[model samples]
Target: MRNRSHIHQLFEALAPKTEQKEKMLQNILVQSRNEKIRHRGFAPVKRLRSAVLAAVLMAGLTTTAFAAAYMGLDEAFLKFLNPVNHEQAQYLSNGAYVVDKQVTNENGTLTIKQVIGDSNLTYILMDFSAPEGTVLDAARYRFLDNDITTRQNFQSVGFKALDDGNRSDNKISLVMSVMTRNSIAGQKVHLRLKDLQAADPLPGIFETIIPGTWETEFKLDFKDYSTLYPVNQNITMYGYEAVLKSISVSPISITLKVDSSYLEEINEAAGELKEIGDNKHLDNFPITINYADGTSETTAIFSGLYLSEHISEQILMIKTFENVINDKEIASIVFFDKEIPIQTGR
Candidate 1:
């Protein structure tokens, strides 16, 4: 029986430990399963967080780029408005002729002088050469009330060859209508001139001819008269006459002069257009017609054609002149027969 007990004790020592050891092993297995489930649940949350962060970063970058582009555009516009030099201003001023004094006005009335340039086109050069310390009101002369009924003539002489038989002259006459400061309401004045005819054919050369009847209309602007010439102020008007001397195909030359009582009417239609804005209409726009002779006629054509061609050109020229004066360059100033584009801040 003692030997049996000893064998039983040896078997117990060799056998695995039970109860407490079993409990520890079960606890370790449950912890490993819980850790694997927690890692699987957190994987989707980490991916979602990364995606949201990336989206926000992209939005911020896009906004920053747009702001930079806007700033660059503004800077470019400003540079065009302010030119760095003043050469253009001087050119326009020097080219213009001003009639500013009373004595020169009297001399112009007595005898007109011719202005020489590329074309025999005539322009009145106002004798603005006044003595120092003279206080002349309004240093420019505009057409005022005048009584002159003479038909002015313009002639263009062309040469077909150098000292050969190819020579011809074209002549046209335009009548002048009397201008008056006194209001002539309901009474229309008509300016009549000789019909324009083509020049005689030149021997051994093709004849070039310009067609269509030349006429223009004139109207009195009370506001412009009041602003430019105040009440009881004496101003002189001059008449223009042109004569084309030796005219070759290349480098044509002409001589022009103004009679004592005539002056080239400045285009005041542009001012009227601006005052009316988008609702403006161009039915009665004014035009100055240049004839083959040394004379021009002012008339008004209340048709759509005049608005599309002549008046439109005048508007574009004025706009371009203003932009250039302000040191700005518009890509291309186009004037259609229809309504002009709206103009904003200078």
Candidate 2:
């Protein structure tokens, strides 16, 4: 691994080199114009115009040179900063690993930590205080999975919060969930919180507002795994920890539905469905239907809004039809809905 200090030095080198080049160009332009005026005795107006044009051209050349140099420096710095083998450039290009920091508070105590991992999975542990004499209650953490589209398939395990009251140290432990992706169909998962309180409501309120509830979207792709593991067994995991002041219902929910007929039609056609209905009132939701077997199809409906918020508005609808095929009542349906907020980092 390249030392952090070395990276800083490299970055510093970039600035001085860039400045020196700019200074040299400026000096060159000044000397060139002075020589032109002295040797040619060109008219003041003509000389001035020539100088300006020359300066513009020089500036353009300088910009191009600077860009090339900067790119070279960037690549070099990345190579040095990467701890893994330099030969693994392809792995770095793909979304394989990431690092992050988190803070958490329980009751009144607080703790913070860092999270890092490869693509398969990782975990973060959080320890926080509990209200005096306040017994442990239920706890949960939420996050958004926006990168589902890039991966083949993605699965996320919820954070497991544990209370260890036996030790002299009073602390609540939190184990961040694991998220895995295996496919390209992108999807996002929202987090929701409920039931929270604090003795010092002001600080809690400030933290809530400062950090607030935010959504994190991730692009899922596994091309990076080939560098470290067998293609079929590549999995990356990471972990994080955060404090909790309070929990409340967030205005976000995700609904996944599968339809059967859409898949059937596609299979019959022997191609991907290219055209879909444009439901203007439904906020242009995208539908995907897949066939799992000959007799049944899975139709998935994704809405930009929550069904609860707009179901009464008649903004979207799903209609199912049943037909007797081979003495079986096969079911198929069309699905639609509005979007909803996704929770992140509780």
Name the candidate that leads on TM-score. Answer: 2
What number of backbone clashes does candidate 1 have, counting pairs of residues 3 or more apart or in separate chains? 27
Root-mean-square deviation per candidate? 38.5, 20.6
lDDT of each: 0.25, 0.32
Q: Would you give me the overall lDDT of model 1?
A: 0.25
Ten-residue region with minimum lDDT total, candidate 1:
221-230
Could you give candidate 2's per-residue lDDT for residues 1-346 as a string of tens digits? 3455554554554344777889998997897778666767557867686789789879988986644422332332232223223222222323222222233334244332322223333233334454566443333322222122223243444444443434334344554434332222223323222223222222223112111222234322222121121111111111111111111111111123222223333233333334444322222224322222333333233222212112221111121112101111112212222212222221
lDDT of 1 by residue, 1-346 (tens): 1233443343344334797679877885786566556667687765675576568758867885544322221111112222223332222222322211122232122111111111211122211222333322321122222222223232221111111111222111111112122213222223222222223222222222222222223221111101011122122222122111111110111111112121223233233433233323442333332332334433232211111123222210111111122212211111112111212112
Alpha-carbon TM-score of each model against the true structure: 0.18, 0.25
Error of 2 at 272 (Å): 33
Give me candidate 2's TM-score against the actual structure. 0.25
Query: Which candidate number has the best lDDT?
Result: 2
The count of backbone overlaps in candidate 2 is 40
